[model samples]
Target chain A: MDTQQAAGTSVLPADPGALTPAEARAAFRSGLAVPTAGWSRGFAQANLIIVPRDLAFDVLLFAQRNPKPCPVLGVLDAGETSGPLLAGGDIRTDVPRYTVYRDGQKVDEPTDIRQYWRDDLVTFIVGCSFTFESALREGGISIAHIDQNVNVPMYRTEVRCEPAGSMAGPLVVSMRPVPASQVADAVRITSRYPAVHGAPVHVGNPHELGIADLARPDFGDPVDMPEGHVPVFWACGVTPQAAVMESRPALAIGHAPGHMLITDARDSQYLVP
Target chain B: MDTQQAAGTSVLPADPGALTPAEARAAFRSGLAVPTAGWSRGFAQANLIIVPRDLAFDVLLFAQRNPKPCPVLGVLDAGETSGPLLAGGDIRTDVPRYTVYRDGQKVDEPTDIRQYWRDDLVTFIVGCSFTFESALREGGISIAHIDQNVNVPMYRTEVRCEPAGSMAGPLVVSMRPVPASQVADAVRITSRYPAVHGAPVHVGNPHELGIADLARPDFGDPVDMPEGHVPVFWACGVTPQAAVMESRPALAIGHAPGHMLITDARDSQYLVP
Candidate 1:
């Protein structure tokens, strides 16, 4: 075995995209910390939301009610650390980083959550827009955020989600600049993956969604917009985390923004004909 | 007002197919009891399952895990009756009839369930295969049960659903005998409605699904199979009811077989593309 494997230290593959979902997870488990974009290229990545058992129903209901914003990929039963989505993997240590929220406030950013994990906490794995980015690229549309080497801009819109019990919040959308000629192609390509955040909710004007400024996003970094490029907004995975924050549950946990759980499931598994 | 309307009694429209979803719901609310197949022709009908709030998360998770048999159309939050799926509708009284289950056994089949209604009960409106029957007809495939004037036959399959929490049961499938030539057409048509039971699980042979005999069904009335017809099976909405029966939750409620809640939402709303 290599020295890095023996020491349980990071020796990530030179071509990150070549690593399997499990390999990427193992790297994260071995203390490699980085955003998961462009990692495990053909596999899918998921957003994480952990809430106490008492509040899980509300979260599940919220996802059912607002599927576009909170498409559930799979859920782990309360205290379960592994499921089919993560074969031979531990949820507590698989993700690159985790955000701990207490009473809706950010309290800690940890690499391992076993210390804070509770038997009463249920984990929800939600679809991420990253899964469809490959489809967009295949359809000949370039991703602005990827080109700019920054996080995709996300804004909390004025549109309120269909509330479910105690869970409610404004829809959060991630924006990408699509070339004027390729906006339709982008929509057609991304719409095929409804399990992920499918289709553009808005095109051309960010102000229409109550987004005052493109450069000032509620979360993530803004991409450079070239002239003749239109801003296409998609329902963001962060919407549930926003809901968790607004509801102010006693405890909640989520993947650190931009970092995600790479799953064994392939991207083609989500693409509809 | 017409005498029939004034009496608060049945004066159903001569052409039951012409009645709007609201009108059909009104008929049911006013003591009319009949199968909803041909009524409200263009609107979507739903399967009903009500469980106490304590068991709702498990039910929701179960549905999430097995979406083919339990595509949730909409969910009525606990203690709430009306929502987007049914405008100005009362769940307790609008459905043609309800089957009350006590510890897995059928206790009552009542036209109205107000007396049994509880504040803690959460109602799940699941998609029914009836929505796709029209698409099949439009594709020039005749339905056996409709032609025979009998209920669609359902059977318990050897296939076990991906369980969630305490909810676990064998998949129950509805079988329709289609002419061998139109088998592809039936699958293509029904696959368009993923919100309903999408596509056939098996295209031929009854014994493949552990069904001993096509004439003897686990639920609903069996139909006459034509000489050239092949047994096609689709995941049935009874799957959740089967789970309820096997899990033996203290109290559970479901729509009696062949009777359903005709929602205001149109069938086109559920048809993909």
Candidate 2:
């Protein structure tokens, strides 16, 4: 089917249906509301951040400084509703949901942000660890969150992000339980894709990255650690979103947790090695 | 000895007699004449590009797109001569020699470029392959050009660089004859230094990269290819200089070939793994 006609159809009634990235994006644009975790398999998903033009340079610098946590996939032109470079998907309504922040407070969860879109907004799409997680799973590493059907445990660490201009915050991380024998393989696999969160930021000791407890997390549900599985921490894409909150912009927007912007771009485009 | 005093005492009659990066840069600023390669032993050497304010963004975008050949070390603001971010080195005179180009033509080679400095000029310091070359040597890979006492063989390739505005040209690659046994080791060693042209662009056959005769190079002298030694090519720093020449800006400035800018930044800063 042609892309436009395919897009005209609403989202699949259930999560089990097969949906291409383009179709999933279309469903999102049509307001077929759902989180994008399992919407488009084998396709790359991105964390979205929308900020005013004045703060674009600072935010971009921050990403550049902390690449592990914020691997920028594409930077859209100011006020551009479509990501022409990355996926040719409309940014306005292509994401199933968005959280609007006004002066550091979450004021609204909008299904479609076309009503709040402005001419001066710049969109930054950052690579999420979902791409690397797929690689790990393919390599036979089991992910506890996927097995338990829970969001990956995320934490705000004592490790401060390299501050850029007015945007500064603690480094945020996501933890995954990995078997000890497969940890080296996991590093080798993820290291090939630096544009995605790359390799694990911390492997054995969680406290080295300033996390005091694996049982307690700043965000997401903590899953039970299986026998012989060690907690591996990676720089999370949610870092920039947290920074935006602490930095307190007059206006900011981001994808709600577990809901990502599905892009037409493939996961392989991000692989370096 | 103090760095300034060391600079004054080390001014030899021939070759300026090997000074540290700081001493060498200070001497270069004070009219000392010499190539910078041998002086800064373990520090990173950079290719310098000075262009007008109008072309800065495009040139930067071009570098971003073509990172293998043109790894950007630091970019100075318009009218600025020193790069405070990279090494706090003076752009106008820290380099051993400067080549001035006007309307795509080489006008003069000067020890210092203060006379050519303009308020609208923006300076770009790009990473050079010397750091990786040093790493290869440390890993016991013998470089033929250093042994033959000639410039590394460089050729203009059929590969087209991603265009950014008016900046676009064929990529230039430097060739090294490596023994077959050391090819894997060479790749591994050089891959660790992404900031310094990274790994080999093309290995083994020169024909693969469209180079017809290995005996004759478009730039630099050809070296002896020992038996069982395969030709390895790397993305050259000259690619951006060639792009600038093609763009034909009214004024362009660069380092004379083999005459690099010695920065206080250590080569260790560029090693990724």
Candidate 3:
């Protein structure tokens, strides 16, 4: 059996949310494949993107240009498997699952990426909206996706990102139905963590963002829009992946959606104030 | 006569402080070299560093690792001369003066760098402390350097920067003596501008930072210490230049001391809420 099939047979932790970030990573390293939402409570989880050294500068420039959609938490230089964010953890094997892309097409979904590791590849650890969701919950706001027990709904809009070299694509956003009264609190709370996707890009009227149907999303499962709650959109980490897919590099790798790299950094560390 | 010598004979504007950023650049483009301390009062001034494309990534990584000392305002990609920060301004001719270095040794200090421009060069525009100095002054904090009619005193501290590839150097800081009562105000006002070297790195006791004498600064002129005042230091923009010098890149270019690029971006734009 392949690594993915073998990992599928492994049992997951009973209470993954209570595990320390290191412990959670250890579970993934031990061949337990699972989505990482609420895996480490207060610890920050990161979106991963690995690109070759030649295109690394362009990716960094793209992230710098479009910070809302791509807040770089940390960068592991070419051939560097570990850095400040993932102490004692090998990036190639710690993630629960990875999506490998070849010429913009998904070729394999591997449990570990050690076979594909290259000396010229650079890893960019991007901030995920999961960090701010905790803050939003702490502020007495309820998230529709979390309440519905599904992945957050994401849509690609007509808004084009500020392009850097060959990296260019339409802006992608995740949706949540928040009560009108708590919208301001959500914005104020999330704005403090600019390292993650901060504040709502569009508070109401999905049509303004060229999103036709609220029930249909380009990625993830749809959540119910409760009465008296408005649809809110935040810049999604998937925007970079979309750019990579559109740009069509020789090889690209990312964590499977909803399956992220649990980092050693705490959510509070990204809070500006 | 060369551009510098010819520009030395050019007449300067009667009130440079009242000129717009574009007008200031026009004057500098005409080969008139002068310090940009009070020019275009409300607009932002930036420190300039240009390196070959091969070394750009290391510099960007270094700046990311050491943000306080090198807050990147904007970057011009290899062979890219204009961008969002400076509209209609040419990076090569808009600055008041340029310092060219060959293998880390100063080779030229010319008014214009058009002759030194190359297609593979990448320019990095770094934030200057002048943006926050105005905020401090507005908050009722008197600035010692401006009051004493001298360049801000800067010292090389013993604290080493987090290294990235070939980039590594000690943290350099600019000093201003603020009254004990206004130290908190100074911190509060400047903290709002993280893009421009936010907050004081060291407040009192220069010995703690390995500075034996306050009067003998490694760069810039020393200012007087008013009675009941304590020395306050902010990370200097020179830190990157120091790193470039230490790293010994084949070629590097920077703005001469006190001479800066007046960007179209306003000081208020950099102020965080």
Query: Which candidate leads the pack in lDDT?
Result: 1
Clashing pairs in 1: none
Tens digits of per-residue lDDT, candidate 2, B126-203, equal: 888877777788899998987786767788888999876578988989888999999999998888888889899999
What class would a CAPRI assessor give candidate 1's docking?
A: high
Candidate 3 C-alpha lDDT tens digits along A1-273: 235433555566667778888878877887777777677889999989999988888888888889899988899989999988889999998898888988888888898999999999999999988888888888999877777767778899999998987899999998989899988898899889888888778899999999999899997788898899999999988888889988899998988777789999999999987
Model 2 misses residue B207 by how many Å?
7.4
Top-scoring candidate (TM-score):
1
DockQ rank order: 1, 3, 2
lDDT of 1 by residue, B1-273 (tens): 246743568665687778888878888888787777777787888999999999999999999999999999999888888877889989998898899999989999999999989999999999999888878888898988877767788899989999988999999998888899999999888988999888888889778788899889998888888899989999988899999999999999999887889988888888876
Write down the C-alpha DockQ for each prediction: 0.93, 0.19, 0.53
Cα TM-score per model: 0.97, 0.78, 0.95
Model 2 residue pairs with clashes: none
- CAPRI classification of candidate 3: medium
- In model 1 chain B, the worst 10-residue window by lDDT is B1-10
- Per-candidate iRMS values, in order, are 0.5, 3.7, 1.1
Worst 10 residues of 2 chain A by lDDT: A8-17
Give per-residue CA lDDT, model 1, range A1-273, as digits (tens).
245843567665687788889888888888777777778998999999999999999999999999998999999999999999999999999998999999899999898899998999899999999899887888888987777767778899999998898999999998989999999999888888989988888898888899999999998887888999999999988899999899999999999877899999999999877
Task: Identify the superior model by lDDT, candidate 1 or candidate 3.
Answer: 1
Give the distance in Å from residue A145's predicted Cα in candidate 3 to where it truly belongs.
Answer: 1.9
